[model samples]
Every structure is written in structure tokens, then in C-alpha cells.
Target: MPELPEVETTKTSLLSLLEQTVLNVEVRQSSLRWPIPDDIQKLRGQKLRKLTRRSKYILAEFEHDSMLWHLGMSGSFRLCDHYTELRKHDHLIIQFEDIELRYHDPRRFGCILWLDQNSQSKLIDTLGPEPLSEAFNAEYLFQKFKKKNVAAKVAIMDNHIVVGVGNIYATESLFNLGIHPAQPASSLSFQQIEQLVVEVKRILKQAIDLGGSTLRDYSNAMGENGYFQQTLLAYGRAGEMCVNCETTLENLKLGQRASVFCPECQPLKKVKIAPQKAIKGSKA
Candidate 1:
């Protein structure tokens, strides 16, 4: 699925649409994860005013309403010349006076929905802070982790704890921090939590700069592939030698997602709580 960085790249490339009036819209296939809203055609004469991203969803603000777009497991958008030939799996098309935007998805898990100007989406309203935002500081994570007994990887991947730390980025971030993915979330110390915050922000920013990691079916609005996959230290390197230490990286399943880590670098500490002594004057 397209994560934050991938979504951000697409949003950035579509920035030129701002102040441009929508000329037409065609829904080749409305059977996506959800049906493309019939009212989407109402955008025909509205001007695109702003474009933003929340988690993996792109918010395109129009003069009247807005649209929420999600590029599912294999969905992408491309910019093309006016009347360019539509490709297979091209589910939706939005045209401007001089150009067109096409949405392609092989799996059809993506969504295109309309939003009222003053409405809030339940999808985004309850999401935690963006991983790179100031609100996602160490203190915030520390408090959230306190109540989570799940694995560190699972906790960080939770949308309520932090947004956009998907399986790929979460695995990579845990590996880079020398923290085992299966480590209990509440067991992480303040120092480790602090480092995790920094590492997640750094990795996410770096991925965005590199155009995101394209394992499969991911590309920018221009159809250019991401280069970050070439720089991965972990995530897909199961049974490969660790770059930090020569130990072979191992893959473990956590919450049904593969987590790759080096045993030598990220050791899962087993805390043993000592048994309490019996009371001195208690009856036998």
C-alpha cells in the first residue's frame, strides 16, 4: 500500500492543480474499496484551492467541497496531456482545461470520496499525530506506550499511537534504533522511546526525500519509481547479514507482519521479577 511518503509525493506533484478549475470527471469503475461518490461530478466548475495529506490519504480542497483519495495496495495517479488514451485499470479521471489526472488501481482497494467543506472525516479525525509532526514528540509516544502491552512494532504501527508508520517504515525504524520489534511496548525505557521518535521522523523524512520505497506498484504522479528501496537496511533482507554486525538478520512475525532484525544488535531483554519474601509473623 502507498504510505505517507508515497502519498506526499503524489500530492506534491499535483500542486499545480491549485487554482485550476475542474473541467470534467469520468468514473470508469466505481467499484473500488468504496463506490466513487456520484456527487463527485459536482466538482466540474469548482477550483482546487489546497492540497494536503493526512496519513496516507490525500485531501484535495476545492472551492466548495473536497475529495479524499487513498492509493490502496496498488493504486496510483498519473498526470497526462488532455485526452490521453486511458490505460487498463484506470478507474477514475479528472480533467482540467489543459491536462488530466488519472487514477489507476489493479486491486481496486483504493477509495475516492467527496467531503463537505465543513465536515470532518472519521477516518482522519481520530488519527494520532503525523510521525514527522511536532505533536509526535517523545513525551507523546512515551505516554501512549504506557498503556499498550503489545509489541513495540505493533504499537507504533497503530493509527491511534502514530500515523504513517506502516509495516515497512516501522520495521526499518525499529531496526535502525537497535530495538527488537517484538519488545514489549511498555517495557521500552524513556531513552529508547526518545530515540525511537527521532529515528522514525528521520527515516520517514529520508524516505520522502528519496521518493519513498517502491517494493511494487508504487510511483509518483509522473509515473517515476521511488529509489528508497535501493537504500533499505532491513525490512526485506530476511536471512541477510546485518550491516552493523555480521550476524544474520532474522525474520519474526509480529501481528502477522514480517519483522526483520539482527539478533546481535537488537537483543530482547527478559526482565525477571524476583519473588517476594513471606511475611515474618504470619501464621503457618
Candidate 2:
């Protein structure tokens, strides 16, 4: 699945090229999970403004309209020649007057939603704060987890709580902060959570710079893709030695997702004692 940084990277890479053209978008395919009305009829000849992004969505605004695309797992926007050979499973295409933009998905989990201008705020209004947004600083996250019992990783990954902290990024963020993935939200200290906030932003920024971690199949707008996978400290290095201490990297199933971490680096801390029940003085 494309995380927040990956989606934003895609928007950044193609915005410059797409903003340069005043061409119409002709839809060759529109059978996604959501309706993709004739691309040309809806977006043709309209001047495209800057590309905007929210969460994992890429928003392309037009004269009075906007287009929403979600690169669900295994989905990519590849730029191919207008006359290039169309391969199998190329479900969507945006034909520019001069060149065409193609969407290739093997799993077909992606979505293409179209909405009128300024109407999108309502659709994505309830989503959580962006990880990079000012609203997501340490103080903000701490408030959300003040007395929560949920695992800190799951809490941060919740879309309604904070956007774009996926499994990979979550694992990486926890590793960077030297915090165990299974740590309870209520047990984390304010200082530790603050470190996590900083690491989250730093990792996301670095991933965006590299275009996003590309191991299986992830590419940028021009099909360049992300290269942060190479810098992964522990994400996919299960059974391998921890780079820092040479300890074997262990893998565990957390919330049904594979989590890898260096046992030494992310030491598990025991929870503090719970409050003891008081005598029934109120009933007396």
C-alpha cells in the first residue's frame, strides 16, 4: 500500500509536468472500484492548478472540479508514450493532447473518485491530522493517548487518529526512537512520545526525498519510484543481524502485521503497577 509520503512524492513529481500542459484528459479506462466518468468530459481542456494531497490521496483540481486517486496496494501511475504498447491490466489512462498517463495495477485495489471543487473538504474532513502537520506534534499525540490502553503502534496507525503511519513507517519510526512496537500507549512517557514524534517526521521526510521505499513495486510519477528501502534499518531484515549490536533481528506478529525490530535497541519496558482497589468507603 502506498503510504502518505509515497503518495505525496507522486503528487510532487507529476505536478510540475502536468501543470505545464493545458491538454484534456481522455479516459481510456474507468472501471475502478469508484466511478471514473469519461475523464475527458469531466476534466478536458480545464486549466489544472497545483497538485494537492491529503493522506494517501492525490488531488488534481481543475477549473471548477477536482479528481481523487488512491494508489491502493500495487497501484502506480506510470508515464508511458502516447503511442506505446498498452500492456495487460492497464485499467486507467489519462490521454493528454501530446502524451498519455497510464495507471497500472495488478491487484486493482486502487480507487478513482471525482468531486467538484471545494467539495472534498467534506469527504475527507473527518480524517486525522497529517503526521507532518502542526496538529500532529508531540503534545497533540500525547493528548490523544493520555489514558488509552491500545498499543502505541496501533494508536498512531489509526487513520482517525493520525494519517500515514503505516506498518513499515510505524516499525521504522519505533525503531528510530528505540521504542518497542508493542508498548502500551498509557505506559509511554511524554519524553519518549516526543522522540517518536520527531522520528516520525524525520523518517517520512527522508522517505519522501528518496521517493518512498520501493521493494516490491513502487515508483514515482515518471516511474522512478522510491529508493528508501535500501536505508531500512530493520523493516525487512528479519532473521538478519541487528546492524548496531549484531543481535539477530526478531520478527513478531503485531496486529496481524509482520513487525521486525532489534531486541537490544528497542528494549521492552515493564508496565508500572496498577492502582489497587480501595475499601468500600462510599457504600458505608
TM-score for all predictions? 0.93, 0.89
lDDT by residue (1-284, candidate 2, tens digit) is 78988898888877654554445454455766665665446666666675888888888876767778888888888777777898777877666656677778777788777765444675577689989889998888888888777778888888888888888899998987888888888788899889988998899999888888888888887878688888898898999998888989998887788889889998888888588787887553
lDDT of 1 by residue, 59-108 (tens): 89899888888998899999999757888999999998778999999999
- lDDT (Cα atoms) of all candidates against the true structure: 0.89, 0.80
Q: Worst ten-residue run, lDDT, model 1?
A: 114-123
RMSD versus native structure for model 2: 3.3
